[model samples]
Target: MSLDRPAGKVPLLELEGLVKHFPFRDSLGRRRGAVHAVDGVTLAVPRGSVLAIVGESGCGKSTLGRVALRLVEPDAGSLRFDGEDLLALRPAALRAKRREMQLIFQDPFASLDPRMTVEAAITEPLILHRLHRGRERARVAELLERVGLRPELARRWPHEFSGGQRQRIAIARALASEPRLVIGDEPVSALDVSVQAQVVNLLGDLIRDLGLTFVLISHDLGVVRQVADRVAVMYLGRIVEEAPAEQLFLTPRHPYTRALLAAVPGQGGALKLLEGDIPSPVSPPSGCRFRTRCPHAQALCAEVVPELMGDAGRESAGQAAHLTACHFQDSLPPATPIREAAADARLARLQSFFSTNREPTA
Candidate 1:
């Protein structure tokens, strides 16, 4: 059933100066280095909205999502959920509070227990949370149908389903507890292009109808654009730009954000891909982490780190809060259009295939 509650203005999830690092040792147990996975990430997620964290694979977007849930602990920083300090909670308290938040992993196959049937996988959370005790089977069937699967399929094993079906099952398991906040760590990246759309649409319906707050960690700009209400562009473990989704794409202030949008297919000119791989987090570049690949980087960029500044003076009320961490955000050149006229027809066909055959939202 669709949730009847309306989204509130208060932030549901807040992260302030969050930092997480992993120390590595050599084969002989000698200290080697530390991987600075999530470094000083501060952001607010309002209740019942979708906030997407987009960037390249090694940029620590995934790590940030995991840290929020305490699946991986942070070395430093404050984590607050619904006005409570998550980091300050005791182990027992934290575990009890977990029902309010949940994670939908990227690899559906690896995330599920192979031995468990679809019903068992989805029912486990209900048992743990002790909800609908006498009617657990009815709850499982309802969840399966909610995620676009047949109730009869609940008895099937994970391997018996298709890639898309497995992902649907994973989502059903995550929603079993009726979490208020859901973090999808590259949830649809593993599926084929055709299947990705179906999952994306399903997620959109769920978020809107259920009034659930979502944190989507992904590298796909198209998927991000389709579902996100706001976008946060991450580079080397820090947010470089954040704005309403349309504003971010239409007027990207960060050089890194521009390069990502420019690379999208059918969007018009030559692909302006960011040069070079991401720097090692163990020894990241000084000053600005993106300076190594930014075409507009100058000597000052290397000498001083830039803070994420808002565009209060230049933008109107709603969009004025757009933030960028570039020293020369005002001087950055406009992006060259990258969409091709020839690609429009193909893009339309692709869109149609994914939009069709999905169950209507309740």
Candidate 2:
């Protein structure tokens, strides 16, 4: 399923100057300030790549995913999919274009319709797009098996399945339209740890087998490390750093990114905890949103915003440039590197556990 895409083609998905804000109002109907969910996000996802957006709760990771799929429209920005302008598509055109994109929601428990059987649920997409017109049940059965569920289970109710199975069904439904891009918003977070590993492995296999351009939104670094090709670290609705997963984990340049890595269990660096609570998105800190919690904050960090800096010519061809947004990144003290051997060993153990047939370990 992994196709060789032509070189220098337009990205499968591209977002620029994206902005979304939720406004609150009193009973008086006066509009209070808005919650700045996403502000000026720009990124590209090449075909067949897994781009993970990682951040703490309310940092706009999920919002960005929703916006990318246009499930929640952005207040401002340009969205291009396969060189076509998504934002400019008319309503009917947008609906037709939606067949190429889909979303797997965070909570599998609530994602399914309680009233609908698994067959009906998965068949909804087929009906919407007028696909497999006379053989919907067979299609549902195929989808169930694709996600590692029994074909017989299609007739069962969602409540009859466990959390992991429910998530598998959700995955099947998202793929019913055979979308080219899928945004998984914390798809594994609601499941238990053992189940999480199984779902993560399934997702990885599907991405490789289906050649999906996937966007995974999660705060779980372990899962991100396992599946992501590119990692974007978001803070207070702004991306602080983005790079290839290995480069970001091994040589994180932004102080915020370093602190996040330091908190991982096997990172083998002196813990570098962020000092303060994240600033409220309603009124995020000026200049740099992370300066409030960033250990390397200086007078300049308060006065001016830093652009995401990277040398385009330095990286090997075809590898993404490692970009970090910090004015003093060059002058800041070098971060302690994560011990590679320990990290590799831990990752190896995790992969082994995922591959084994034995019951999941506690």
Candidate 3:
């Protein structure tokens, strides 16, 4: 959570120029335009740190998470994990690499097999990786306990557990392989507000205690604020801003990011609210995808695509640089503090609950 950590170290996972598109076909079976799910996204997650990718629904946050783990093949990109080329790996080699990376999906109900008992579900990974061998049950029990669930619940069916408990089981399954990196796509979004905090606290503890690198994909800014070390703000399949969690929340540079924070209930700011719906990904705006809704958009915004550039003027000594994709980020009017007298103070109280040293409970 500290912004003072020095940057420039090699990351555990590095993705560059990543692109994934889902093409459709006409009645004649001929190919039509593709849905630009992820376009030219480059991001890095340092070892033992948490990077949260935040955006509204359909901005390609989930697709980016899947592509990062190679569950979805990218049309173009360079992906390196632990300093190795991920794209060049053969199927068999990629299967082997799966042991080091896992995903905790969004819907726990769909993620778990109804017929499979809790133990069987959690042990599947150990079986696939040829781990724990004859000790699979023991390992499953240990994993169950680690995620703050009772080991005895291993025999229960997925349908028998509550939403939060199912998510804990999903977490246990993700960690069964003892992965070096885990991508959680909306991991706690479906849970109740109180339950979300419990799961977030558990994840924070596991990431810290076990030194696991994590990439969180979620729209819940409160959850992101509670656990993320850094945050990437995505819009229309592209990242518009990236900065340390505290810095981004305090001084967002991109118009899209500022609007997002301002839209949060009880937060007051001078920024204009976004006016229109998000443009279809199949045919996004020519240049800046967000220009259509951005109040600061000018004629130049429609002609030239803005590149993500570091804000050198705002960087503090030894802190990670804040990067913004707005062409006139420097020339733009300064942002007023978004916090208002009636600002949602509950978020801070909620964050403190999950961020403390107290142990997680069921």
Candidate 4:
């Protein structure tokens, strides 16, 4: 649970102007406007580090992950992996390149085949990649042990394992290829709180031990804080802020980023609760997508789009690279600390009551 930074080197994944739109159709199949699921996303994943893409639901983080793996074809973008053009690759070549990149989905049960045994499931990738073929069973046992599961559990089916176990199996499958890059789209969100911590630690260990580059997509800031070396805050299919995890959390530049940090429990700050529902992506606001709900929005915000820029005044190298996409980012009012003694007392009483009344574990 240390907040130490990752020592990542060269870029493993490079994406520029990535765009993916899902078009809507009428009853008669008439094409209508498209859903801007992913729009102009530009990012880089450094080798042997974890970069987290976080935002509210439907901000296109999931779609961006799938698009990175080519699970969903992007309409427009430049994707380069390890100095090779991903978009220019043929089908057969792309299939071969997949061994270098893999995805760990959110729901372990849904992603895994119910009928497949643990051995069959974990070894499928090994078989596909034609690795350790003659001794696949032994390799499966090794992978099981690597993920903190017993070798004998290879005989068990998906139904017999707990939620965390299933996720471990999924992780093993992803690692069976010995991929250089792994994209985890809400991989730990489905597990219980206690189980979530175990999986998070497991992933952190795997990434460090295997020298893997990770892109974690999640809405949970707490989870992001645990594993990410860097973070990108997305809104309406665009990244509004990108910075080192500690710097971003300590001094958030964008108003939206500040609002999100304020919402976390015990993180005392003025809670600037965002007003109104998120606008439909199909017809997002013309200029700043978040202007509709931004407290500091002005007439200029509606007429011009702000580009993501690094902080010019920050002296620290890491803080200097903190990017924020707001025209008046420097002018935004600082958030005051929340001071509600009565509320804090009430919350403490409620927590104590819950702890006393909780059911004992077996």
Candidate 5:
């Protein structure tokens, strides 16, 4: 993806301090509490770029994507799409703007309407936008082939196709309205490994072929590294680190970011074993959200929150100069154990630590 921007080119999408909270009700229908699904998320995606948001489940990545696209309203903050204020839009205007933004969900099996034929599924968006009328039939047929499905499959239901093909159909439907932005939330997580690659490759081809800006939410590091131009690491409800794909892979700054990298299937060789588990989002630890899981935690780490991940300069020794957030500047080295042996190492270390350490306090 092209990184250079024209002198005055505005980002295709921007979210400043976006926040979302889902309220939970008791049996009496009284508001009991709220789930902080997304909090203070800020990001910008340039035109024709793919920005992948990576984090474990329940880290608020998907919620941020939905809020960015206005699929869900934010509790606070700004969302601008194509220079228009998303939260400020009226219902009718927002509905109209929906044509420019679409979402590709995670589940290919359950996301589709079982009763609808492939033709109807792909043409619904086109019909809603009034982009094509009597032409929808022909267009559906063409889209089927464009997504690598035969025209004969148009009459069939979603259950009739393989997972990969269904995902392709989903892609076709997302493209039906000729949207400018597509938020793909774990688009291939539900498919087989090989099929996952197929879907990812298809998305990569589509993004390049159509010049579409994508906000990809995924937990798959390999896929993100391959398909994303830039990557954002989210923890709890905030972004801890972000950088170009190559840079992040080569060097991650925040302790949380390091732990996340270590957790990747083959990233362990790049660092020592990670220290702890990610804290529950509902009750995140005080100060640095990641301190509870970070091995580098110290008195100050628990008192002062780290900034966004960036490179070394003022940050701790291990942090990259451009890394956005890091509290310790120059003392704490990065934890890179190389990933191949991570699982075995982690297991061995866990066994040894448990054997040597005292029992947990109840």
Candidate 6:
């Protein structure tokens, strides 16, 4: 179901200056260093619309989702949901808010308990929130049907269902609270290609029918393209680009954004391949974290970290905002012919060297 208009609406959930760091210490429990899991992320999920957070694995995409629910306590930042401070809420208040928000994890198989029956699984949240009893079992069956599963299947164990069916059960559990917001973390990535589409469409239907807001975290660009109203592209621990789905697919401003788009299969009529590995987050490159791999990068890109700034000329001048963190957004600057070319030459030479070194046996 498509949103009527994605702009001019207040976000159901908002994050400002959000930061989370994990501690890794020496043997004596003394501080060693911190993993910069999520760094200064600020974004929003508009009421009744889907906002997709797309990035490669370990970019803290999952961590950000957990932080949104206060599942993992962050080292710093502000989180607000419908005008209430999420972080400032006490334990009991937070639990009450939990009823309004729920997360659908990435792996259905891993998320569900093998020991519990489908009915028990979905009913667990009900019990935790004190929502049901003897007669409510019939309602559980209704939810299963709503998610396109048979009510009879509820009596079976998690292992009895196919991958797609198990995921349906997971969705049933997430909807148990009749939550206002649903955070799906790579909800369909684990399923077969055909199954992936079915689940995606199901989610879209649920969002529209229930008037639910979604914060989707995914690496499947195609899925994101299919379901997202707006998109945020992450690198390392920060959002480097954010814009409406159509605008991002068409006129991506950042070179890193362009290069990331390089891997999108179709599109990119004659662009180069994505050139390098994401640097280790522990000791990320100076300036733009993506500068090490971005093809159009210059010396200045390596020296000064560009902040997320919007181009004055983008499509949504009034409502939609497009922000890109790259100094070269205004113009493709001159390059220093990075050491990458030399490395490429060496790789070709090495491949040829190994080919020649192989003896042609008689």
| RMSD of candidates 1 onward, in order | 4.0, 3.2, 3.6, 5.1, 10.4, 11.2
**Model 2 clashing residue pairs (backbone):** none
Predict model 6's lDDT versus the native: 0.83
How far does residue 89 in candidate 6 sit from its true spot (Å)? Answer: 1.0
Clash pairs for candidate 3: none
**Residue 348 miss distance in model 5 (angstroms):** 33
Q: List the candidate 5 regions with Cα displacement exceeding 4 Å.
A: 25-32, 267-271, 309-321, 335-362
Weakest ten-residue segment in model 4 by summed lDDT: 1-10
Tens digits of per-residue lDDT for model 6 on 1-362? 22454547567899988998887889999988877888899987778888999899878899999999999998889999987899899999999889999999888899999999999899988888878666569879989999999898889999888888888899999999779989999999999987886788789889889989999999987898888988999988889998888777777777766766666664424257766788877767889889888777789988998888787876355647788899878886432121222357656765664434565332
The global Cα lDDT (0 to 1) of model 1 is 0.88
In candidate 2, what are the lDDT values of residues 260-279, reduced to their tens digit? Answer: 88877865545666676888
Estimate the TM-score for candidate 2: 0.92
Write down the lDDT of every candidate, Cα atoms only. 0.88, 0.89, 0.90, 0.87, 0.82, 0.83
Candidate 3: regions farther than 4 A off: 1-9, 268-271, 340-362
Q: Residues 202-277, candidate 5: write the lDDT tens digits.
A: 8888898889999899998888988988999888888888888877777676777776777665542544566657
Alpha-carbon error at 340 in model 4, in Å? 15
TM-scores for candidates 1 onward, in order: 0.91, 0.92, 0.92, 0.89, 0.87, 0.86
Over all chains combined, what TM-score does candidate 1 have? 0.91
Candidates sorted on lDDT, descending: 3, 2, 1, 4, 6, 5
Error (Å) of candidate 1 at residue 215 is: 0.6
Descending-TM-score candidate ranking: 2, 3, 1, 4, 5, 6
Model 4 local distance difference test score: 0.87
What tens-digit string does per-residue lDDT give for candidate 4 at 48-135? Answer: 7789999998899999999988878899988889878899999999998999999999999899999999999988899888999799
Q: How many residue pairs clash in each candidate?
A: 7, 0, 0, 0, 34, 0
The CA root-mean-square deviation of candidate 6, after full C-alpha superposition on the true structure, stands at 11.2
**Candidate 3 local lDDT, 117-211, one digit each (tens):** 99999989998989999999999989999999999999999999999999999999999999999999999989998898789889999999998
**Cα distance off (Å), candidate 2, residue 345:** 9.2
Q: Is candidate 1 or candidate 4 better by lDDT?
A: 1
